[model samples]
Target: MSIQKPGYKSLYLYLSLSMAPLFLAFTPLQPAYAEEIKNGKQVYEIGCAGCHASGVLDAPKFGNNADWLKREQQGFETLVKHALNGFNNMPAKGGNPAYKNEEIIATVAYMLSEAGFPNYADRTGVKAVTTASTPKPAEKPATVAPKSKPATATKSYKNTNQFNRLMAPSSEWNPPQSKDGIHDPENDGTEMLQKPRVAFEPLANSTSGNRVDWVKALHNGEINPRYDRVNPDAMPVVMDLNIVREVKGSMPNVVYPHKQHTEWLDCSNCHPAIFIPQKGANQISMASILLGQKCGVCHGKVAFPVSECRKCHSQAKTAKK
Candidate 1:
């Protein structure tokens, strides 16, 4: 070798610079990531776990390799941003307003770790912090849901208890007035209507989907049972059907026209499920209706507003001209 004084050489400098990048590459990235994941686990268990754990509404299931992998492909930052701001059918903060940006970030990290990233799952970050899930002594396989029973065909159509509660807000009618005299922000009708949604398409036909106009449409032959599957040609239309309540009843007895509703909807739509065919068989309550239970099912939703009290309270003096 040629004798030379030891000094900074280009080769040595290049190697030194290269080593810097290598060192940085090995630096632990797990600290902050681990912290976020821990926090994320807590937030997710409280707010997100309900739907996400079971994949309700198609929420990404934890440890569901496919759903998590697909979400991961979208980029981790993007996923966090979406959870913070709500995406698609998910309402903002997954419908939990209390979750702050930090809480949401942590929740997202925890979800990702459970999905696939082992570093996030290590739970080795920071000195001391409350963990979302307790560390188990041994890792256990995830519980797989049992297969559902095949539904047997029923004799008549019966609605689930949550029948109309699942409907989108009716655009046709104004939101119900709150006790405070302000427009109630919650549709209080559908959990989905934290914000107003598009109204259901107008019944059969008339000018718009207005119920009054729909009734008029039935009176005229503008629309017909020509379309109804149950009664293709009007079965004996029960006209002037009056439901008279007890004399001491707080509100006037309702005058229901079978001719009108049967005109648009199938009989199974209201039968034993919503309204039992027998009179006085079901207890009708104003509180329940206002809560969108009984008559509130249609009024103020797709048909008309209960505010028009005179419309249904059409017994004797209370009858509208």
Candidate 2:
């Protein structure tokens, strides 16, 4: 005796098989969603963390619900579009054009999930596409050290060619004087120093180079820095000459404007000392710059860090007709 087939069961079976293609048409297939999130995290750590992690230029802070509230209201797809294109101070794809749309979407999803809104990714209809282009996250080194045997008494050789770790985590960016690694934390005067954010609040904002547009700030009269310490009456001799340096490779040529420098500094600050007065007299390279010579003397030290390539390499290479 065969059991009577239910109408609902028959309808369900029919719909499951017949509508499979239709359902898939609307829904994007994201088989490796977990992998995509992992890749997204890596991408964020490398690039997005620079601004998002710290809320630089009013960017929504990573994992901060308050900062992301308005952004989250716009929906995931809208946020994705903003990231792919450009939003306010943030450049397209976080200023890295090489990043794929898939990676950027995944990154947005990852950020939303951390910001107390995990369902936004699902509401968007299109799941983030995973790509192999995203670099793998580095593995954590072993915390336990190896057991030492009997040690022979000898003079240890110190490595003098060690390089400084220029790339710091977002948490360290513009840290308080007491907490900042550069200052002596134990010193009594350390805590008295004003935080960079508080001091820089009145200054004009910049996307790069210490996050403060010094030249723009000076131009707008937000900051009137003294040209000389001894002579308070001395004024800056602001030259408007622009020196263009031809750079080899795909990078843009360097446009060094004397006007910006002279606005705050004197001629003796660089001429004949840091850079030779005569043209072609001093040989300069990235190696020398990294070693705190030439442009690097002021760049990586007091000005913007050397990592900001576009700050100096502003002149786009003219297309060869």
- Which residue pairs of candidate 2 clash? none
Q: List the residue pairs that clash in candidate 1.
A: 40-106, 40-107, 202-209, 300-304
Q: Against the true structure, candidate 2 has what lDDT?
A: 0.63
Q: How well is each residue in 1-321 modelled by candidate 1, as lDDT tens digits?
A: 221343448435655665576555532321222222235565576567778999987898977878888888887567755775567645555654334344455566677788877665543222114542333211211121111111111100121232442333334243323211133334464444432212323334322234345566567655454653576664543444556554334566567767667656677778889889897786665544655776778865787667766567777645443
Q: What TM-score would every model get versus the actual structure? A: 0.36, 0.45
Report how far residue 311 has shifted in candidate 2, in Å.
Answer: 2.1
User: What local lDDT score does residue 258 receive in model 1, on the 0 to 100 scale?
Assistant: 72
Off by over 4 Å in 1: 1-47, 54-75, 81-106, 109-222, 227-238, 246-252, 261-283, 286-311, 314-321
What lDDT score goes with residue 147 in model 2? 19
Candidate 1's displacement at residue 137, Å, is 34
**Candidate 2's TM-score:** 0.45
Residue 241's lDDT in candidate 2: 92
